[model samples]
Target chain A: MFIDGRALPAGTALEADIAIVGAGAAGITLARALKDSGLSVALIESGGLEWSEEAQDLAAGELGPQTYATPDTVRLRYFGGTTGHWGGWCRELDAIDFEPRDFVPLSGWPLKKAEIDPWYAKAQSVLQLGSPQRYADSEGIAKAAGAALPVARGGDIEPILFEFSPPTRMGEVYRAELEQSAVKTYLNTTLVDLRVGDDTRTVTTLTLARDGGPALAMTARHVVLATGALSNAQMLLAADSQVQGGLGNGADQVGRYFTDHPILIGYAAILALDPSAGGPFAFGDIAADKRRWRLAFQPSEAYRAAQKRLSCLITIEPPGPRFDPAAGAFDRSDAKWFGAPETVNALAAANATGPVRLHVLNAGIETRPNPDSRVTLTGKRDRFGMRRLKVDWRLSDADLEHYLLNLGDFAKALAHSGTALLRIPPDAAARWPEETSWGHHNLGTTRMGDDPRTSVCDRDGRVHGMANLWVAGSSLWTTPGAANPTLTIVALALRLADRLKAEMAA
Target chain B: MSDPVARAWAVTRRTFGATLLGALGLAAVETWPRWAFWRGAASSLDALAGLPQAAALKALGRQAQAAMAIPAGYADTLAARLGDEGYAGAVARDRAEGRLVSIDGWLVPETQALAGLWLASAG
Candidate 1:
């Protein structure tokens, strides 16, 4: 099961009623949901039981427009995929994201927020998080010397409501459950290509190559690709028989709409509420979303009104008497493992002479989607003999503009709220560091919509061209609201599971 | 209407709107970890090579983080070592100016490693 540098078990019987290409949050969640179905399932992963050097390499290097600047954000080849080391920040997509926002173009999900509300309720138990109802206890957190998030009133652009766990590591938390499954789990196996019936576009068989051997073929009644964003597109592009462009290449939409949360940090420092009073990006002053305790941001009323739509979270950390060793509050493992040293070096230099900034607040903003921002087949193969992905991440100028604008006002508010306002000089671009990469919430690649022409999948995560192929996870996100998207991804996966089950029964 | 604070507020509000508003409506375009391309392109032509896990996840360690929020005098050491690429010295500067002080709310379960500066370091 854990063989390396080669392909699948030699001459292995590769037949299953249902086949899932990844063993991540999406695949594992779905496999468990479909347990009793008469259909046998196959879950194939490129990596093995735990983290490995081989897997880490897939997460590194540059791929077209899809660049993995922060290798730490993903566990490229693992049993639970990247969920092997997730930060557990959970939140549901806003009602606005599900509904057609009057002002947002190419917005809206096939299903409504109400449809997934029940699913979110169920997912909470799986993630081992507290109930969503009592999530926000801002007053309680505020009483602490420094709570990082502020209390948020639901119903702005995103009426976000959900909670986070200390962070549910998929490998540590779900290994037992997976082992108990009757489902066949093929580790160290990568989906290299798809063979299609000449006339019909339906995928006839899945070809997998593990380590480095001749490809092995798999036949299945249905195929579900729960591969992370980059690999999902890579597999489709490599499936050359049915379509040269890729499996869901009808509109050439596989890698398009490449969007990452433009998380700007240190751009603004809330000047001086009381260094003692708790305001800004400090832990104590951080406003929670409804009942949740995490610090979050939304468009400033000014930006909201004009529709700049970008929002920033304020984290005013309590002047720590000492760092909480128990909480391990400061050891950002993901950052250390994946951060570009050159970039952080520049960021640190920019902040070399400031007050003890309480917390580093991130501004998670949505970027405009461009069809050109996409994944193309690089024709380069990994050790597994499959092609790599090319990432074209183009950000809009408008993003940088407002973060700076908000920075100025934020500093002013902090000053008025209390301190000697801190500011980044207007021309400090060169002095500033490379922007912060997102938290691996890869979204919008196979965006969902009513029309198949514009998007790759329908609202329920079913691929348009294929009857049995489905996708869940951030990839279906048309609008990744400012909230952390894992909870939403889980919600969508649950929704898809329920739909699939119901349809199977019908 | 002519009060200095009010004047400052008005000018400040307009400037904020001017710069950050027009770009509203759009959201999250570039992706996180968008690295599949160059590696794939290289591999496509039979040129892809693997890197070490320690190097693959080199960013996941504490040394870099410890170095990120060095005390005022610490950066000068690396400053000489990294002449052109020396960190703009943001940590040292932010510390001296009280800018990096107690960022109370800007934390997640684990962000200390990123900045290292805490309340004791605050003014």
Candidate 2:
């Protein structure tokens, strides 16, 4: 049953076996997964089924030192969360992403990729991916495209594939299911405080409010903070009434180590000897198995291990017009969408000499974990009387230096294969953090680990010292790999749902 | 030291003559793209071989060396290496050693960039 928080009386109180805050990808997935498990679930969202200006205003916060997408614009607060505008780019994290690397500090996840492989497989259906096998079939997809990726032997780069989703909008797709399910959906409700009992370990009650109304109360046997990476930490840090610092923030590790994939566009230009030379690099979409896939290149595992570099994926943009597979020609009508004008001009100038293809290269590289990159509570309060967030996103100088070195390695590999010659702009390194855009993937902050000092959650997604309080979503990620986080977010949510069922039974 | 002219020679006259005829023959069959690329490089070497000992070729060579800050006399060393290992071989070596520079937004092998700079200066 759906209940509008506005309709409830100011002093109303409710109870449930599980209370999930923020009905985004993680919250909805967890709520849906818990169905028929004999648990009475309550999903509390900060917005209505549809977006409104007033609800979006609640997402406003002070900007950080880095020029990032405004906090209000980065995430949505509605029923489906940010999946309302998601692009549906999905890929699982690499095995190395979960391992502890000697070169990277504050890295490694408490759970291994092998341990979460089943959840990722199950998440493929939730993400609307046609086939789970399609993601790993790079060779088959390349064969279907009639051109193999130009990966040279012993080269520092390897080809990878990204599968797309019709981008299942959870609110629109699962609205009827949610409406008919046993779970209670509360809209326009914001979690303001987490009240703990005398022990201060168990969260006995939750204070919620709606649109400047009087605070209401809800008690749950278990509480899962399914808010996004930014808000998860923001909500935890803002709940300082009970705990001195905040709930589960004894060591001051609640809002630190915030991370996102820093994107670099037009970082380098590629001049191919001919059109076929650039064909292997997914200048356009590769159609296979009646699904769309894109090919990109990343540093080989050996290369990263040897060079001590972070994860990065490089994509190529075709010059002139997009390639039309059916017509087997460039679609000039779509030329307006093409980026990298300099590459187009370069190719146009060289058109007479030969049929050369120019390509602009862009990269999405991981940021190293830094304690200074964090989210903290601001002095100002939102309409719900909860403190606003102040994000201070940062990237270390060493991370940027490693990214440039990785680009250099990719350039050499391309040249060595005689596929193309890559030219990195003179100011590529100096323009970082300013010229960089983002994947809009807010991650870490409430990172999971075995140690309480460094992480906010444990291996099973529970808070470090608190019982019955868990964190879900990208905020539990210890390291954000270069892949998009939505798939993993849902995967981890399903994993957390199983854990919750087991814990409840125990 | 060997004769400056011989050391600077990228292709011997006999090889250049044979390749020029071969390139013309292949052009009739529309298969001269590979040779056409090599012919341009060979022609640049031919021009460098004809210049004076203290010509602009040496100055352009120094410029290329300064971009990488390796050594001062790389022009002669690269010229000699280009003579010993053909155009493809020398370029492969430069790629292996990461000795390439971006000239006007084009990544050029150090040896090839020096030759192009010399040709531009000569013109």
Candidate 3:
């Protein structure tokens, strides 16, 4: 049963097999997966079903130091978590995302892409995305985008597609299943503390609050935190009783290794191919990988490297006389002409046509993993008196260097391929000398790895020090790649659920 | 529960007055996307009713975009960086920010503007 954060029940303690916190993408996915099982689960969320201004504001970068999904970015803080506001783009973590890179320090996942492949298929089925397990579908997508994308010899590229589900709301999707289960969802019952034993070995109980009421202590055999990247480590460090620094903080790595795919509107232009919109193209088209998807682009090696993902979307050109959809230029969409996306589109169009007949889509660059810029709990408490998260987030210099290098190098490659042109390459170069940053994708606080010393959680997401505790969501992403991370988060939660189920069975 | 000090100082009244305009603005925004579509649909329907032939589309486009405007969020964020004030200003700034392609002027901007005009005209 759900409880309000401001109103506490008369009871002193509640018991459950699994005490899960924050029903975002990670929490909700795991909860739903474990719903049918008879094991008791108490799913807690700080926000109610609908939009709350306070909760939304808390998600914003302007209000908080950590910013992935802001008030404007997501309709978060509900049962479904952040999925309500997702654009429905789904892709598996690249096989390379698991490997350690000599170039990128502190990069690599202990688990590999092979282990995740089965999970990806399961995730695809759950998301109801079309099949993407084959190359024929990818070829179909390449054809859909038009004949410009060069077919590779090595089969080096992975074809990832966007799935627009009836907007997967984690809460609503799992609501019916959860109602009949042993799992009890506690909405507005915020977790205040994750107390551990005297030896800081196991999680004893979680101190939770119902809005303005006195805290309730709940004991559980296991506890998992899926409260996003910023909030995950925030809660860990806030549990001051167990360790001086935080839970699973034996290495003082509670809030280190933060990374995100920082996006930039790179060179954009007018394609020479006139757009015939009605024929074979729609923003919502189907690709062969059993995934219904849209236009795709090949990100650069420097950009789409291990732990780095750059999802470059090539949108339909703006419907105008001189716009060329085939050449990656000339968009008449509002993005090019009206709002922010439109404005960027317009910039691309102008750059692609006239004296310069080329527009390159924005490069969504991934940053180097930096352990210094991270999140921690400030002594100051939130509505629950749990230490509110104090986040210090920033893009690193390596991020900028690679961003520029990849952009330049890719522009050169496209020019060499005779598939692209830079209207004013020198000008594009000049403008990039000064660095600017934006916050949308926050990642890597409680990063995942086998070693307890460097990472907060084990490969399966169990907290290193506490066997019963696990970290979920983007917080567990040791390094974020170039794609939007929502899909990856869902995939990770699904994996964690299997482990949880097996453990309970044992 | 009203705070005694705030009540005594008439803060509630003042705060309410201050937010009155913002509330209206939000209401306008909430309805704008739908409104745009509504006007667009109405114009197209009217065109089909009035002139079922050549210019039905052309007529519909104009009606929808009669009051077409960009959201203030863009103006506050990307536009300011690019040096734009409003919708037209934002587009103009966006075009200006790009490297000059036309020997004298960029043709794509005009084409984009025409497209916007078309989308708006359908209203």
lDDT of 1 by residue, B1-123 (tens): 669989999999999887566444222211111232123333211111122111111222233344344455433332332232212232233334444322221211111112222211221
Candidate 3 steric clashes: 58
Worst 10-residue lDDT window for candidate 3 chain B reads B99-108
DockQ of each: 0.01, 0.12, 0.01
Tens digit of per-residue lDDT, candidate 2, span A1-506: 78898889777879999999999999999999997799999999989999998888888898787999888999998999999999888889888888888988989999899999999999999988877666656777888877666664346787778888888999888888888999999998888899888888898898888875677899999999998998999888887887888988999998899988988876676656434664675457777877778887888767788878898988877654433233344333322122234333323344323445556777888878888899998889887778898889988778778877887777767766656767776666777778778998999889999999999999988998898899999999898878899999999999999999999999
lDDT of 1 by residue, A1-506 (tens): 22242544576658877788787888777777776676676777777888788765664435443334542244357887777677777765556556555555676677788888898888887777767654344434444424322323432321122355656777667777666767778877777787777654567788887665567788987787788666677667677655767787777788677676766554433222223324434443233433335544444343454664544443333434323334434324322211244423322322222232323334566555566766566656666666666676666566566555555555433432233334443343442225455556667678887787788888788788787777767778776666677777666677777777776666
**Docking model 2 quality class:** incorrect
Best by the TM-score measure = 2
Regions of model 1 farther than 4 Å from truth: A1-9, A56-61, A64-75, A134-162, A278-292, A300-308, A311-360, A404-425, A428-433, B1-123
Model 3 per-residue lDDT tens digits across residues A121-148: 7776566565546322555565655533
What clash pairs does model 2 have? none
Error of 1 at A215 (Å): 2.9
Candidate 1's DockQ is: 0.01
TM-score for chain B considered on its own, for each of the candidates = 0.19, 0.41, 0.22
Per-candidate clashes, comma-separated: 142, 0, 58
